[model samples]
Target: MAVLVPYAAARPKTRLSDFLDSPERVSFSRAMLADVVDAVVDSGGNPTVLATEPVELDADATVEVDDRPLSTAVNDRLAAAADDGDDSTAVVMSDLALATPRVLSRFFDADGDLVVAPGRGGGTNALVVRHPEFRVDYHGTSYLDHLRVARDIGASVREFDSMRLSTDIDEPEDLVEVLLHTDGRARDWLLDAGFTVDVRKGRVGVRRER
Candidate 1:
């Protein structure tokens, strides 16, 4: 099966800027992408990065550039793959730092024409499209939109739910999730950068020891 990883090479992961500097955000984004690619490779899928610009990744992946909006680029690629008679295509987000080969294998092995793994706040973290007629929308509340679209197109749909697949590192709050859930490079980078979870006022949040 073909796995496509869409990455924003330019100005990536802006939400975490409050905690991470620009350079650190870039480095952390790349580290998360590497972890996702590693899971894809370990799952025995043909992994390719659909990058917005030319950026290097250390993991085993081939880079393809499409500077268009994410939904457009991914939809166009899926359509072309269907035209090429490919059976299915998987689009795995680049920021799933806690993702593992087991989670990815379960995602790819889901029994349906359209399988979706929803992110924490109404985003699509991963998807597998087995039907040529199915497409995607990555806008706000996209997980619900995808479910509606799948049903409208008469395609069988399944939803996969797991912390490993659902947890994408986007916000500052997500740093704690990574520290608690993953031992990957993203977590290591956070620790090396002096980030740790601290409890204050009956709530837990990430903090930097400086």
Candidate 2:
């Protein structure tokens, strides 16, 4: 299947957005997208990046980057992928803390015209569409609200586990939960990137100033 990673917002999009509120979170978002790509490539899958930026720095031959807004550009990129006519398509978000190949494999294994996992925070975290000429009406919560649209278009539908397709990284509280699931590799990454993690040795919060 052709995997789609949509990076719609830039590093700092607007004040109303969460990731833009702090510079640290902006860097975190960028790394999160990169990690999503790493997970896909490690799974020996074809990956594409639908970026809102003009140019992509890490796009390889196996990956093609498209610059477009999430509402319009994402579908445009997927349409281009479908043009090749060689693969089914799965459109996924980039800010998942626990995105593993096994989790994604579940979606690939399902039998449906569209396999969707509802997002924890409304909308959908992942979408798998088997039909060409697939049009998107990606407005507020429409990713989940558009099941009728899929039915209207004569497409079959199925749902997957939410934990496998979560995009829960818009708040610091979410970050705290993500760190709970970070394995050795991801933990080492956090350390290497200057984010410290220390478990409480006693009934006290772990703290080390500087």
Question: What's the true lDDT of residue 12 in model 1?
Answer: 92
Clash counts per candidate, in order, are: 0, 0
User: What is the alpha-carbon RMSD of candidate 2 to the true structure?
Assistant: 4.2
TM-score of 2: 0.77
Model 2, 102-188: lDDT tens digits are 777777678887888777656777788887756566647876665876888788888787574765455534554445665534334
Which ten contiguous residues of candidate 1 have the minimum total lDDT? 197-206
| Candidate 2 Cα errors over 4 Å, as ranges | 12-22, 54-65, 184-210
Error of 2 at 99 (Å): 0.4
TM-score of each: 0.97, 0.77
Shift of residue 110 alpha carbon in model 1, Å: 0.8
Cα misplacement distance, residue 180 of candidate 1 (Å): 1.2
Per-prediction RMSD in angstroms?
A: 1.1, 4.2
- Candidate lDDT (C-alpha), each: 0.91, 0.62
